[model samples]
Target: MEKKRYYNDNIGPIKENEVLALKKALELCNEIGDITQITLLIHTKGNTGYLERIFETRNLKDFFRGVKIDQNYPPLKIETVRTFNDDWQGKKIVVAFGLRSNELHKYDDYENVAGIIAHQWSEDSVKDWAQSWGAIDLKTETEIEKTALPDKVVQQAFIDLTNSINMTTGITHPMDEEQCKTYIRALKKYDYELNSKEIFSFLTTELNWESDNANDVIKLIDKVNSGGYFKGGAKTGLQHHIKRWKSK
Candidate 1:
């Protein structure tokens, strides 16, 4: 009897049972935060199985629908390089995503292919994704030196604000005073850990701000976790202000 085959758009042929198993495995990986990287193996008739790891960084949840590749082959990897300027500082974060075995030279449009597979194939899309990921969208140092924002005070304020929030918090920008107070109160009320998905969900459902995009809630939560205005808690003096706002 011929071996059963399953099909997916990107990965081609896979065993149906294998697909189910991979999906279950992916779920478990994500739950435990082991999903920082994922690899898919594809098996096709008349061709050796192909291994690929497509998603990178935050692109996992955004682009990865399911691991549709076959499991018969070992995981293969190709390098993808992303170079973009930071929002305010013009710094660059070089991100690498992988491609399948021998797929690099198969086409002349390697750059575009890598970009699409990484879910940030376009320049504009890359900028958007980077900013959403909290990469500071600032002018480069050279640009700032040449055409510095006229107001030195404002420039310094922005610099201070950006530096205050820790990078590990995954926040690229700072929230305003009122927004800061609201976030803190919610944090205290729900007793949710800073930057947790629970806080993200609460902000999405509870806040009635003008920006209601679910993604915005996540962004704000990122700022909160990065120490935003509430950095160092009461010692930073922001807690006093937040307390006053809560009273109002």
Candidate 2:
């Protein structure tokens, strides 16, 4: 099956305004006690390369952990790096980068990942998914940075506001086990040979699940298969269940 494309426009070079916004967002995350890590979501490989060059030029690559490239549906390239300032002694913030259409749910897999920075052109669906999982939306957070208040004051206010609304608790896997099993069964019925990317597409387009939720189901499938509880793992873990469902 042909993979569905979430974004159609080619991302241009990172603009100055975007850089300011990114810096502001990173600064906020750096100052807030609850947000020690962030993931940068981009839409294209060019954007990923642009960001890499920018980070390198700015000496931001010094904190890099690694990079991952996914050639599947909604193809993505990720760079995991850390950010810190001298003022904030003993504090280092981890920042990850990936395609916006990829697994927003995977943010939870990292420690202290309470923040997310999406490219300005990111779709509403992606932003909403991030918000639903309790990750701080950098766009919204950066708006506060625009205020005239002192940095410390704005940081404190932002902290208090997020705390009141419970935004700092970190990401959550909202899809339960049964739901995941159902999704797996659906995938088996769709095509037993489907790869992980195709399974994600099926979950999103056929099952009407948000991308994040679909990705959550995918992770659950991996976990169950890897645990050795399911025979044949992802290749055939729930074939028996799928056959029964198909007959019904």
Candidate that would win on TM-score: 2
Candidate 1 on 1-248: residue-level lDDT in tens? 11111111222333442334334334433343312233232222112122222221323332223332346322222222222111232111112222231221121122121111222222333232222122222222111111112122222222333344443332323444334445454444434345333333232222211122333444555666675644422234445543443354
> What lDDT score belongs to each candidate, Candidate 1 first?
0.29, 0.38
Alpha-carbon RMSD to native, per candidate: 18.8, 16.5
Worst 10 residues of 1 by lDDT: 141-150
The digit string of per-residue lDDT tens for model 2 on 134-176 reads 3443434322211122223222322332233322221132323
| Deviation from native of the Cα of residue 182 in model 1, angstroms | 2.4
What's model 1's overall lDDT? 0.29
Clashing pairs in 2: none
62 Cα displacement, candidate 2 (Å): 4.5
The superposed Cα distance between candidate 2 and the true structure at residue 70, in angstroms, equals: 32
Model 2, global lDDT: 0.38
Cα deviation of 112, candidate 1, in Å: 31
